[model samples]
Target: MDSRLDDARGAGRRRIPVALDGLEQWLRIPSISGDPAHRGDVARAAEWIAARLAKTTGAVRIVRSAHNPVVLARVSATRPAVARLLVYGHLDVKPPGPGWTSKPFEPVRRGGLLIARGASDDKGQFMAHVAAVEAWASIGGPPLDVSFVVDGAEEIGSPGLKAVLDRHRGLLGADAATVLISDTKMAGPGRPTLTVSQRGMLGVKVVVSTGREGVHAGRYGGAVIDPTQVLAAAILRAARVVRRLTGAGRPPGPTDADVRNGAAGRAVHRDRLAERSTTCGALTVTSFESGSTAGAIPTTAKATLDVRIPPQLNVADAYRAIAAALRGNDHPRVDLQLNCMASASGVLLRQPPTVRQNVDRACRLAFGRPAASISSGGSIPAVDLLFRIFGRPPILLGFGPPDDGAHGPDERIHLGDWANCVETSICLMGFLSGSVTAASTQHPDSSFSDTLFPHGSRGTAALL
Candidate 1:
């Protein structure tokens, strides 16, 4: 084992309690961004993070927006040649759903796990970055310049974050080829993973209406054109078209090769792909409403659908297809209205030798195991926006374990994984700083040959 790794392991053991204490305190604030009532709590959480970052030997500022404030801090190096690393994380959490063993606002420790609303989704995972920075600052800071951007409205699709980045682009400039984000999780405990790509997402709510008023089913059953029935037929047609477009029920497309290659890289752990695809079904049909009474015909019907597209797919094209499908239906009485459309562009991680070597070496030094690159099915819109604004590929790495139950009740972070994350963060910083160097000398822009998968290879059909 390397001396630095030994030091990091020792430091991580000593700092676990401190990190846990901080996580508990941070999780206690109900910074739910979607709820208007929790605005004060959101600001309070931002203030707490800003104060914490200010304690370091650097320039820290609280950048506020109309929605929530972002904590931006910087530690400069003696020379510009040294790489400048950007670290980002979120402070706000989702609303706590029912079924928690304890109160969502109160962090509880039981069976070596910390349970709270934001304990795992982001608050715990991102705090590991804070803990890592704190550890470095405690030992006189890093050799390279480092910047931290902590946001508070990530749970709400980061509405104001792009504007914030655009406004402060000059202050956040960087020459580094990569950025680090700890907002995602590993496949599982002891299986260190790096997320290389994330599928794009588009959410839309469609409401169909026909008649002006609801009528008794007995009198209107045969006479009136029921909007609910018409809407259901339209939805069915849209579903079949989407299935055909995705090549779900037919032979795989050429893109299947890429999917399989991505899956192979991600399948280092058992059930990893299965876990990633678990959201495919649950991502759609968030809510629905139809009949007002059991025996009455509904005048209006509404349903919200969340569509997740792979990195290789086009989002705008998918929306157009959906709109055409809804409009082409021969329901004279039915009208389709699109409520909201949130689309995220996809990004692929740069597979530079330096990046792969650094991530692999760092994971080995920290956990005595090699790390694997994986594609995440869920979407992180910030990843696309940040990369576009800064022109740097953001590396998604974290210490979260599977079944952490983010956005669900009883959200928790594994204590052992938390300690491992601390060690990993320290080792990654040291590795990137050249405490350890790679054997290969490849340019950061070098592109590797993409391997395609058999399952995702078939081309999608024209749904429109």
Candidate 2:
């Protein structure tokens, strides 16, 4: 074992509490991007992370975007860098939904888990990498010069990411040899799973209007049509439209056993798990407004519909189908308005063997086993753009448990798992930088032939 790597691991273990403290402080900020009411909170959260990164890198800056600020940070290796790496993660999180055992923003610890809105989904996952990098710096820094681009609007499709990247190409590290994204989850506690694909997304806003304003329930209840009923009908129609198109037969998606090797919560899904992976267009009305005053018939009901598109279907095609389905013959009883909020295509990552082998090696060093690869059902809208900009597929590695309850109440991350992730992250820098030997890339007991010919002369992980 390399002495420097060993020292870094020691340093990381000692500072586990420090990492938790940082994550806890950041999690307290409710950076919900979807709602206009919390805009100031979102900005505060961005600055909080910026300050933390700045302390280590001394090169942190927050770039203003149309919707939110993007925090960028960079640091060089102690020795000559073997590679330039860009890390992508979001600081923003979804609006805290219902069913909280405690306050959504306030982080709490129970045994080994940290409970908070962004704990499992992204903040904890990404912050693990930051903690790893800082620990490595305490020893002798990573073998790779590192750059971080933590965005603040990932919860809302990252609508302005391309623009931000376009405007600040070199400042954001255009020459990155590879990209790292930690916005995914492990198959299970000890399973270091790599996510290789992401579903696309189509955001639609639906509005149903029956009158100008709310009227007395006694006066209008009998004669007028309720917008809430029409709104519910529209939502149902949109969901059916997606199922009809994406579910022509069985939807193609990860099955129950395939999700982190069945470590996920059991469900009796209507479609097969793999059938649902890419084909189960999970249409949801994320937010809705039916009435303001009690006992009064509201004139309008609005909803924000989020349709997840499987990698196989075009987002545009799905959007059009949903729009047509909700139009519903345009009768005089109700006025329906549909707004296209955002749309993005799904991406399938093509992993070069070197990337896979090195990542496997990194995981094995920290977890006592090789890494597993899986396809995630979730969507990260800027993945395709980030891949295009970086000229390579981003490695989607994360440490959150499969059932962390993200985007809902009681979202949490296990500390034991997170520490393993930090150690793996430190090891990944040395292995991925090509500073670690080629033979180490193979499983310890594997024969030479198996390492070279694992896939028959592809020479994917061969030393240069």
Off by over 4 Å in 2: 1-3, 79-82, 210-233, 247-254, 257-274, 288-299, 330-334, 437-464
Candidate 1, residues 111-187, lDDT tens digits: the string is: 55677888878989888877876776665565457788888888767778878776765566554535788877676
Which parts of model 1 have CA positions greater than 4 angstroms off?
A: 1-13, 78-81, 175-177, 245-283, 435-464
Model 2 residue 331 CA deviation in Å: 1.8
lDDT of 2 by residue, 1-464 (tens): 23476667668777777888889999999998889999898899899989988877787889996779888888787777758888889988888878788898999876556789999778889998999888988876777788888888888878788887777666655476688888887776667788777777888898888878788889779777888887887788878877765533442235666553443344546446575665467787779988999889989999988888876677887788888888874558688998888877777776899889878878887777777777766788778778878789989886877667788768887666677788788778777777644233433343222332233211101111
- C-alpha lDDT (0 to 100) for residue 117 of candidate 1: 88
Candidate 2: how many backbone clashes? 8
lDDT of 1 at 34: 84
Measured by lDDT, the strongest candidate is: 2
